[model samples]
Target: MVFELSQSASDALWLETHQQFMPVTSADGLETISKIPPQLGKGYEREVALQPGVELHIFDSTYQDIAIHIPENQHPVQFMVYVSGVADSGDFIYQDANWGYVGGSGIQTPVRTFFPGAQHQVGVIVHVQPHLLAQLFGNSESKLQPTLDVLVPGDEQPQQVFSSPTTGAIRAVVRQIIDCPFSGVTKRLYLQGKVFELMALQLEGISTPVCQNRMLKPETMARVQQAAAILRSHLETPPCQTTLAQRVGVSDRTLRRGFKQLFGTTVLGYLTEQRLALAERLLRDTDLSVTEVVHCCGYSNPGHFAAAFKRRFGITPRQCALGVISAQS
Candidate 1:
């Protein structure tokens, strides 16, 4: 149940099984992630160095109840976005559909995380070294102001979790990072750009009214978030407006206003965007055909789906798929 992050993937696995950290070998350097034990449930994990001192971890899992202890190196400031499901870190419970920002130093503090079973959670974790922060801020910490400063005086300075509701802009960029259609140095550049953009969106949202509103009524916003999760869970056939509101224990008006306020989109509109985004992912990552993609995205007519797809992305699904082929070839 204890996991350590040393220098490489193999070292992490060793720490998990042996309860001790070890030197990272060349093979460990080549692989970027610790494989999730089967008993923990099915999942894929990836860790990649997008730049010196910066690593991004993407984990998508459908697991049962579990407790995991993670080592606190106190070295990197961490940022996360829970694409879905709740993340229970013994210190704080970060609910689904939120952006999390943790900046501090570490002090050998044992951190534990819990995840309930049967729910699919997609999360992106970015770890940044202080040196990289200095570089990003023009070699000065003043530019980062309060956000970059460690909360604790010493030790465990890096593990304080600051979480907030995710904005629509931040979610879109995260999807792009997860679904990037590139490899090699190009993929690194792509991911690094999205990471920067994600941070920019987080900064821009700091002063926005939506962020403030989220803080005002946590319970109500959470209900709206429930409606959102419902939509995502049933993207191909989501609940109707009234049914959704009723299910979430909110009035239709509250659901509408809250959805717009919290997510920057109406319920139906958000559903549409989610469908299209999933379509984009399928067309890019899988061998799904254009017609199948359209059907899966909840569109009955290929022509209509094609037109809307082209409008949103400036190219049809076929064209996008073709471009993937051309690039790979």
Candidate 2:
């Protein structure tokens, strides 16, 4: 499946191999995935920018037939979020706001595919250059260095894979990026600010106490991922510990251990984080009132929601919503 960089290769011949692909990179940096295809139904368009160490791609479209294959190879550390749409790269799927991944410097990932059908899809892919990786982890060459220590030079596969739902702070900032309502220098400044905010969120995820020496088996990790997915599906009403464990085919003890060892957050801690993240997005993006947002996120009372939102973003829901709107203006 060799997709042309300038245009979409005809799908009939393209899917003969039936292989999915991930974004590829050359020695210099990430190569362009593809430009506008001829049959861009519902009119697909993208806005891209390479601002210093950061690169951004916003794919908003309803093009259903084009086969997207980002050939795999060494690329910079990538953090992608699905603002809307569903993509299938083998077993992994990407969905709005709730998804995030930290791919290491040199790994051969498979071809990634997105299934937008006849509906509109929106997503943002952020690439951080490897040279910036050094600065991101400070000037340290020690084991304390997050990427070097965990992401590693790598062996046959990636040493560390941090893929999970993002926090509300991240969701809020990314929405600002996709909905950025300015152009020229003002727009650039706003974009730069949001990009850095994303960086900070990824940093927090990567900084989770490195259990470099500890390893959880692949099976257990899969269960942990399944558990997280279940939590995502039930954002309005998460399951209890025993129920969640049964659903994922794991004991509560094992589930807790897997989360800490593999995902770097405990079960309830991860759930609370995910809930607050969802609530933050609801408040900032939707017209849901504080009470509705609270109930929708499975919180019984507005008091708890306000406190959690403030704890996570340093502001109440109403304040954050107002602040986000002001920044957008």
Candidate 3:
């Protein structure tokens, strides 16, 4: 199917295309989940209002080849991540683990085409109001990082579009959003935190020059991603860099460079970040004590773990467990 629609006509567009798909709203009216029509394909699309100025859209489905033409219009800042499938716009093509940022006023639009494939197209799109984004950066007086200046562009600044391969850390966060295990207000709070996390990852990616300029070969990038998966699967005893490089069939040097370029961090740095993130989740959701959480996250010294946890999360494990802090805080 092919159609043309304005960026603001989302509800009307959805209604026109999927007449059979009914939106089921949650009890609190904060979320709506709609299944794909049988004739179109399989799976569903979920929309959540995380807060007054932030929204989350999660889609997982497969269908016949489709093309959508978006007319020139103003748009909110959007962070888009695709876990699989292919989307070809005139100037850019997005595929598995690809992410991009698009926003600005009075910008020309592209004809985005999605091709049918064996695997489902799954991912999340986060929309944040320009003012909210500015507030998150501490208002107009705060200096925006050079790379992210486009996000809050001046009236005369041209619209900007940025795209890149996502890091393992980003994919992990995306999965957490897809499989969120909470409901009601807790669910909104959790997803809101994740939306910000996604924004932070994109901010980190753009801030680093190497991430913008250094493009690894597809095979090498795949190996680096594999190495990351290994680290996540074995957080308690991740392989050493040399061993990991060997396992992924990349040289140690290549692995190091790839990690920096694709993930914006060193191998060890990424591992540490992931471990600390896991620790935070455990402290919040599980009944694990501080010491047990530390051990589960592969830390030995309680003092060292507490220090690192505080550095990463701005709160100690005990504080997080006691509900003294939230994911957004």
Who wins the TM-score comparison? Answer: 3
TM-score of model 3 (CA atoms): 0.57
Higher-TM-score candidate among 1 and 2? 2
lDDT of all predictions: 0.64, 0.62, 0.70
Write the residue-wise lDDT of candidate 2 on 118-162 in tens digits.
556776778777667666654564433644444445445532345
Off by over 4 Å in 2: 1-45, 65-71, 92-95, 139-144, 152-160, 209-256, 260-329
lDDT against true structure, model 2: 0.62
Q: Which stretches of candidate 1 lie over 4 Å from their true place?
A: 1-34, 71-75, 138-143, 150-159, 203-329
Residue by residue across 113-214, what tens digits does model 3's lDDT show? 445444578888888877787667543443334434556565544445555457888888889999988888888888888888888786665445433553
1 against 3, candidate with superior TM-score: 3
lDDT of 1 by residue, 1-329 (tens): 43332234534544573343232322424226544545566666667777777888888878767656656555455667877766665333344665454443455355556676767888787887755654564323343333343322344342444345587877888889888787776777788999988765654443233345534243455466557766765677777899989987889988888867766888888888778877887798779898888888888888888887777787778988776432321
Where does candidate 3 have its weakest 10-residue lDDT segment? Answer: 99-108
